[model samples]
Target chain A: MNLQVELEHHRRVLIVRLRGELDHHTAEAVRTKMDEAIQRGRAEHLVLSLEDLTFMDSSGLGVILGRYKVIKSLGGKMVVCHVNPSVHRLFELSGLFKILAIYENERTALSELEVVS
Target chain B: MSEKLEQISDHDGNFMTLQFASRSENEAFARVAVAAFVTQLDPTMDELTDLKTVVSEAVTNCIIHGYDNDPNGVVTITARIEEEIVTITIEDKGNGIEDLELAKQPLYTSKPELERSGMGFTIMENFMDEFEVVSNLGSGTHIRMKKRIESKKALYN
Candidate 1:
C-alpha cells in the first residue's frame, strides 16, 4: 500500500529505488517526493530501479512521464531500469521506451548514462 | 454500501463481494486483495499480474471518472473464480461516460489536466480475455472482465 523510496546519488545522477505498489494511490506522493529530491540541485540525471515494484498502472506511467518532462525541461536525461515485464509492456504501450531508455539493471543504466556508479 | 467483504457461494461457483468507498487507497486494496483470492487457482505470476493490473485500472476509473474523486461515492468489486476462469466486476454509482468509444481510445482522457494517460480501458482490454464496459451518462458505470487463467498443465503441454 505504501511505496518505499530509497535515494542514491552518483555524482549528478540520482538513482531512485521504488519498492511497492505504484498506482494512482501512491503516484502523487512519489511525484512529490521525487520532485523534492530533484529540486535539491544534486541531480543532473535520473535513474529509477523498479526491481521490487510490486504493481503499477497508467497513473504510475503518468508520474514517470511527468518526471520525464521535468528532466527534459532541465536538459537532463532520465532512464528506468529493472522494470518488470508487465510494467515494461506499459512503457511500450505508452511509447515511453522511445524517449526513455529501459535498462536491464542499475549498472547498465549508469553505464549508458555515462555516469560512474 | 457496506464496507465489509461478503462471501456468497452457489453451485455455479463461490463468489466474494467487496464494497468500499471511492477512495484512491482502495485501488491498491482492490488489486492485492483480488490477487490474493485468485492465488488459490494457482495462476502464473504473469496471469496474476495481468488480473491485478486490470482490476486497478477499472477501480481507478470508477473512483476518478465515475465518482469524480468524491469520497462519498461507492465502488463494488465482485471476483469469482470458477474452475480456471476468473470473472470480476467493478461498478460505481456516479456520473458515467458520455462517449464510450472516445473514452476507450488510447491516450484519450477526459481530464488531461489531471495527468491521466487514458490507457485504463486499453490496458483492461489487453490484460483480460474478455472486457465489457457498460455506462450511461448521468447514471453510473459497470465493467466486467474475465480471463481463463493458464493452468500449470496447460503451460507444460
Candidate 2:
C-alpha cells in the first residue's frame, strides 16, 4: 500500500492530507513525513485530513499514537478530520478518540485550531 | 455495495491455504491475498477492512513476536468460505506466547520499545464474530477468526 502525504502550511498549524492505505508498509513513511512537516513548519498544532485515507490498521494506530505523543510533548495539539467509517472504527477501538480531536472537515479543524491558537 | 459482490455470491464453497517466510513484506501479501480470496463472500467494505486488519496483525505477530523477526520462520494462513461466512486461520511455527492472559490485555506488549500498540488481539476480537488464540512457549501461535458477512437483502429488513 502506498501513502501519499500532502503537507499544507497554515499560519499556526500543518495541514496534513493523507491519501491511500496506512498499513505496516506505509506507516513509517507517514511518520517520517509528518514529523518533518511539524518540525519544518514549526507549527503549534496539527490538522490531519483523512478524507482520502482508504485503510488503516494497528500499525497505523501506533504511528498515530507516537505522533500524538510527539505533538503533545511539544505542547501542540493534533486533530483528525474527514475520517471514514472504517478508519474511524479503528480509532474508536484503539481508544484514540479520547485523546484526539475529531472534526467533520478540514475547515472545521482549521477553525478549531484557530481558537486554540 | 461493490462490483466484487456479484462474483462472490455465485461461488458455493472456497478454501485456500498460503504459507510463506516470516518476513514483514509477507504480511502485506497475506492481507491482500486473503482479502482478495474473501471477496468471493461479497463482504461489505467494513467487513473487508476488518478482515484485512486482522490478517495483518496475525501475520505481523508471526514475523515479529512469533519468530522474533527471523526471516527463516514461516507463517501460514488458511481461509475458508461457506456462503456468507468466512473463516481465517493464521498459524506460525515460532516461539509462542509465554502468558496468554497478558498477551490479550489491551496496551500490553512484550516489546514496548518497538512501539507496538498492543491492540492487535483487541481488533481481531471486535472485528470478527468468533476469535480464538492458541499458543505455547515453544510450539507456536494459531489464531482462528470467523465473520459472517451480512448481505444487503438482510439489511433491508
Candidate 3:
C-alpha cells in the first residue's frame, strides 16, 4: 500500500501516525505535511507513532532526522513509538536511536512529553 | 569431479529482470517486484523486510544519485536465485559517482539539501550478506547484492 500520514494535535504536541511504506517516493509528501502541521499548529513537541507502518528506508530516516532537527531548533523534542523491528534496524543503522527517544506506545510517549512540556 | 560439477549445475537458477524509467514513483515498484520474486525461497518476515529495504535503498541511489532524478534515464534490476541464495543487481544510465568512498560513507550525503541521510549503502551492506558497487565518473553505477535466505524449510531440513 501507499503511504498515509495521519496527524493528531494534543495541546502543543503533534502526533503523526504513519501507515504503509515510507521511501524516497513518499518521503517528500510526509516531510511537507509534517512541516506544515508543526508551523500551523505551533507544535512544540512531536510524537511519531509507527504502529501501522509496514516499511521504511533511509529516505524515511532522512525525513525523521529533518523533522527532529526542526523541532530541536525550536527548543522542542521529538520521540517515536511503536517502531517495528525493521524500522528499528534502520534507526540503529543511521545512529538515529542516539538522538531520538523511543516509547512503547503513543500514550506513553504523550505522557512522557507531558512531564517535559 | 565431473559428477559433482554436474550436480551443481542441476540446481535451479530462477531469475527475473526489470527495466523502468528513473522516476520517484517507480521506487516502490522496484522493491516490491524484487520482494515478490524472492518469495519463492519463502523468506521469513524479517528477511523479507530486509530484502525490501535493500532494494529500496539501491533503487533510490539509482534514481537520485546515478540519474540525478532525470526521468529520461533508465534503471534496470536483475535478480537471480540459485538454491537458497538470492543475488540482485541494480544499474542506472546516468552520471556516475565521482567518489565511491565518500558516497558510501554513512551520513555523508552529496545532496544534503534534499534531506538524504546518506545511509543508503550502509543499509544495503548491513541488511545483505554481500554488497558491491561498480561505478565510473561518467559511465553510471552498478550495485550488486546477495543474501542467503534461511527460510523455515531450509532450517527444518
Candidate 4:
C-alpha cells in the first residue's frame, strides 16, 4: 500500500498529486493529510491529481468523497484530474463525476479552480 | 451459488487457499497473491486490475465488516483457475451481515464514521462476470466471484 501525497499550494488552491495505490490500508493517511492541509492552508479550492495512481478501490472513493465534502462545507470547490480508466470507472459508478469537476491534468484543474475562485 | 462453488471443486484446476489474520495490512497481500496466482493464465491488464480490485473489496469487507477490524479474526481466500476462467471465494468467521440486501446498495455504508463508500459489493459484481454473496446472520459472509479471462494465448489463436 504505497501512496505518496504531494501537496502544492498554488495561490488559494491546493494541488494534491497522488502516486501509487490507494486502498483501505492507505486511505486513512491520505484523508488525514488532506484534511490537515485543507484546514491549515485555508485553500479556496482543491485540485486532486491522480496521474500516477496505479490502483484504487472503493476505499479510495470514500477518501476522495470525504475530502470533497470537507471542501464543499468550507465553500470551496474540489476537482479531480488525471484519472486512469479504472479509477474513472469507480468515480462514475459512485456518481462522484456528477458532483465534482474533472480535468485532464493538474494545470488545467488548477486553472479551472482559479477561475471559479 | 453453493452449487456453482461445488462445480469448481469437482473440476480439475489449479487452486490455492490462503488463511490469514483479518488485519488491514493483509488486504494488499491477499489481492496481490490472487493476482499472482492467476498470472499463469495471462490475464489482460484490465482483467488483472479488475480481479485485484474485487479481491481487495472482498478481503476488506471481511476485515472491516465481518471481523470489525479485529486482527484476531481469520480470513480465508480460495482461488481456482480453470481453463480461462478464474474463481475466487473469500470467507471469514466473524459477525455476518444483518441485512444482506441493504449492504449491497450503493453509497449505503453501515459505518459512515469510517467513511466507507459502500461500493464494495457493486464493484465486485460489475467487475466480474458472475458474483454472489451468501452469508448467515450470526455466521460470516462468503463471496464467490467468477470471471472469464480473455487470455492472450486464446486471443492469438
Candidate 5:
C-alpha cells in the first residue's frame, strides 16, 4: 500500500496527486504529507488528484474533510478530481462534494484554480 | 474434536469458518475468503458487491469497535449457505457494545475522534437481508447477517 503525493505548484495553486488505498492505516500518513506540502509549498489553492486511488473507507473521508477545514481556515480553496466509482460513492454519501469542489479531471481542477501569475 | 473454526458441509449448508487476528491485514483476508467461498455459486455483479460490502463492514467493526484496536484480539468469521440463503457470522472477544440499539443507529459511533461514521451496522443492514448483533458488556460481540442468493430466473428474466 504505497501512497504517493506529488505537489505541482503554479504560483499560489497546489495540485496533489494521491495513489493507493486511504484507510485508517494510511490516512495519518496522507494527512502528514499534505500538511507538509501546504506548509512548505505555501500554496493558496489545493487540488487533490485521486485518479489512481484504488480503495477508501471512512478514514479517507476524515483526511479529506480535515484538509478542507485546514484550507478554509487558511483562506484557500480545495478541489477533488478523478474519483473512481467505488470511491465516488463514498464521497457522495459523505456529502464531501457539497463542501469541496469536484472536477472531472486533474487538469480541469488545476485550470480552475489557475493563479493570477 | 470440534475446532473453533471448522468448515461445514453444504448438505446442511455450504459453510466455512476462518479465525483471524484483529488487525487490518485480517480485513483483507476476510474479503478474499468471502470471494473464494462465493465463487462456486457464480454470483452476479450486484450480489458480489453486496457481499463484499457486508463482509467489509463486519470485519471492520470487529477490528475497530469489537477489538478496540487491540492487535492481540481474535476475530472469527463463518459463512454458511443453506438452500438459497447465505449466512455470515463475525465474532470478536473485546469490549462488547453496551447498547445494541444505540449501536445500530445510523451514524452513531463510540469513537468519533477516529472519524468513524458509525454507519457499519446501517450498511450491513442495507446490504444483507437480515442483520443481528448479539453482545455482552465485557464478553464479546457477535454479528450475524444473511442474504438470499438471487436465482438465475430472477436475474435473466
Candidate 6:
C-alpha cells in the first residue's frame, strides 16, 4: 500500500506510483492519495504507474474512473503506465483504454503528459 | 436456518469457504480464495485468469451491495467443485437488493456517484457458465456462480 506522487507544477503534471494490491480494501486509500495530490498540486495532467500492483478489482476501476472524471473536468489529461497484464485485461474489458491513455513506461507517460500540457 | 455463519467442508473438489468482515476484506479474500481453491486443480493460465476476474466481480457485489459498505458486516464465500464445474457462492446479510432483475442490468449501480460501472453482474455472467443473484429486500444477497472447466483438448479441438 505504497502510493507515491510527484508533482511537476511547471507542466501541471502529477506522477503517481502505486504498489501492492488495489482491491476494495486499498482503493479508497489510493483514491484519497490521488485526490490530495490533484487538489493540492493543482496538476492538470495525471500519470499513474502501476507496475507493482499485484491485484486489482472493480473497486480499482472505480478509483481510476473517478480520477479520470476529476482531471477531465479541469480540461486536463490522465495517463497510466506500466500496468501488469492481468490488470491490463481488466482495463481492456472495461473499455477504460478507450478513454484513458496508457503508456509502456512512466517516463513515456510523463513525457506525453508534458506534451499535452 | 440459524442466522449463523457456517464453514462447510470443500466437497467434490469443487469449492472452499472463508468468512470475513465487511466488503473490502471480502474483496481481498476473494483473490486469495480463488488462488488456494484452484491450486490443487492445476488450472491453466487462462483458467486462472477467468476465475480471478469472476471472483472479483462476485466478491465486490457481496461487499458493496450485499453488505452496503458496512464495515462490520460479514461475508461468507463458499467455493465448490462438481465433476467439471467450479461453483462459488458469496453470501452477506446486509441490505438486500430490492430488485434482482434491475440490479443485474448492465450499468445500473445504486452508487453512481462512486463511479461504479454496475457491470459486476454482467462481468460475472460473461465469465462464468451460470450466474444467479438471490436476494430479499431486507435480508441479504446470495450470489452463486458456476463455470465449466474446459479441457486442454478442447483448446485444440
Index of the highest-lDDT prediction:
4
TM-score each candidate: 0.92, 0.90, 0.94, 0.95, 0.83, 0.84
Better of 1 and 5 by lDDT: 1
Q: What is the interface RMSD of each candidate, in Å?
A: 0.7, 1.2, 0.6, 0.5, 2.7, 2.0
Q: State the lDDT at B15 in candidate 1.
A: 71
Candidate 2 Cα errors over 4 Å, as ranges:
B1-12, B152-157
* Residue-wise C-alpha lDDT for candidate 3, range B1-157, written one tens digit per residue: 3574466456579877789999999988888899999998989989988998898998898889888888999998988898789999999877889888988899999999999999999989989999999998888899999999998457778
Comparing 3 with 6 on TM-score, the higher-scoring candidate is: 3
In candidate 6, what are the lDDT values of residues B42-112, reduced to their tens digit?
A: 56766777788777777777777776677888878777777667788878887888877888886678888
True contacts kept of each: 0.77, 0.62, 0.95, 0.82, 0.13, 0.51
- For A25-49, candidate 1 gives per-residue lDDT tens digits of 8888899889999999799899999
Order of the predicted models by lDDT, top scorer first: 4, 3, 1, 2, 5, 6
lDDT of 5 by residue, B1-157 (tens): 1654343552586778788888876665676688679766667766766677677778788788888888899998888877667888889888899988998887678888876766677768876899898999888999998888786436656
Score candidate 1 by TM-score against the native: 0.92
Can you give the lDDT of residue A31 in candidate 2? 87
lDDT of each candidate versus the true structure? 0.89, 0.86, 0.91, 0.91, 0.77, 0.75
TM-score leader: 4
Q: What is the lDDT of residue A33 in candidate 1?
A: 85
By summed lDDT, the worst window of 10 consecutive residues in model 6 chain A runs over A1-10
lDDT of 4 by residue, B15-128 (tens): 887889999888889999999999989888999999999999999999999988889999989999888888899998889999989999989999999999999999998999
Clash count (model 4, backbone only)? 0
What is residue B118's positional error in candidate 4, in angstroms? Answer: 0.8
